[model samples]
Target: MVRVPGAKVALSTASCYPETCTTAFEMAADLGFDGVEVMVWTDPVSQDPDALRALSDRFAMPILAIHAPCLLLTQRVWTTDPWTKLQRAREAAEKLAAPTVVVHPPFRWQREYAREFVTGLARMQDESGVVFAVENMFPWRARGREVAAYLPHWDLLELDVPATTLDLSHTAVSGSDALAVCDALGDRLAHVHLADGAGSNKDEHLVPGRGSQPCAEVLERLAARGYAGCVVLEINTRRAVNRDEREADLAEGLAFARFNLAAEAAT
Candidate 1:
């Protein structure tokens, strides 16, 4: 496990119920999170920098990162043009004072976008102060048939991306070792989506330590290596019975991060 002393532990806004984006900021602040990653999607406020900045001020939690509206559900957030969406996300990041923007690779069908992804990403990073951290996505499998869902696959070591958002749940679905993947990432690792999965093809965003991923060790490793990136708890609590259950799950994930972080310091 890597020890990242003084690193901020943030909560991805998408980790909470999709009712309202501000709900996430409120919960995160109440739970003692140092910052938050705003996942921009259909929520009107998420697309508005002013609104987000207001919430950040109200909660006193900084917007650590901005997740671009790249998922299928968010296809209509900014614009149909993938490049435009990225640009909008970058603009939002700059407005919110977020340092990183998390994005998913293009789908296989978007041949044109995929073709220019690497080069375009480079240009964006060169043009902006923010880092475009491409996130790892799992493959789609059905009836023993596997489909290459993402342009760069779930592992990003080969991509010429300057930075990456290492998602533990995606690695679990990809059947990749967390430590090995982190090792390969090295300096390119700019952010982390802290979650867990049961090594199933399903993208189960389980709480840290609830699945097969070495969640604690990974945290410790980050601490030990003096990682400066923000650690965002991106777990799924949609299956929770109620608000209390969701709060409990999120609390547990935060506690896990804190404990491992402290343990690393001790060692």
Candidate 2:
């Protein structure tokens, strides 16, 4: 439980700028984030892994990247002749010296592929020295418990790993208490996906403090439980006006977080 905070903005690739990894790194570096989390697809036609690593190094931030099998990018879990794509992802993560790598659970592409995918990721973790984690899908059962029950169950099912992303907004969308989920995860949690939401079945990714979920309260809960994973905010970069807007949002989130952190310390 380290209370390590990291700001999350987007790269230029997704919707901000299509051909600007270097530009994206420059902008992300200016945002004062501890690390950059990237999501890439293993499909043959998807973005290049080499370019991703180059940008990560350019920004002087070790990578925290993800690779999920996507349909357009050949969304195959452990089957589907996905060796080429998986190898590419592995090589890229290694090259970037990324500390954490997230893989999609087998729920989306194939439910049966979960075991092999996790095992493969374990092997990748061993080979690359990266913390391999899998994100629990939206329809996971613990959504009923504000993400708590599901966190333990999800980790138990994974078996080999001991970390997760406490997506407070996703839990709220599922009609659950995000703080309670934090309690369930305890120290096994690795990071958080932060965003304020209206506590409905929506994932609009509202700016912090604008939606129903209290961002500061969530941080307080994490601190109380001695959970020190990264509190990385995720927003749609495509919708932002420019880098300045993204930075402003991050600044506000940081202020809100600092207040909660201080309160947590006092408590």
Write one digit per residue (lDDT tens) for candidate 1, span 18-112: 54789898999889999999998788988899999999999999999999999878877889899999999999999889999999999887789
- TM-scores for all candidates: the values are 0.95, 0.70
Strongest candidate by lDDT: 1
Per-residue alpha-carbon lDDT of model 2 for 1-267, expressed as tens digits?
Answer: 235334333322222233244554565577555565555633222356666666666778656654444333445543365445556666666777655555544433444445466566566666666555555434434455443223223432334456566665566665566676666666656666666678655555666687877677777666655554555555445566777775676656546655565333342
Query: What is the lDDT of every predicted structure here?
Result: 0.88, 0.54
Top candidate on TM-score is 1
- Poorest stretch of ten by lDDT in candidate 1: 258-267
lDDT of 1 at 236: 86
Model 2 C-alpha RMSD to native: 5.7
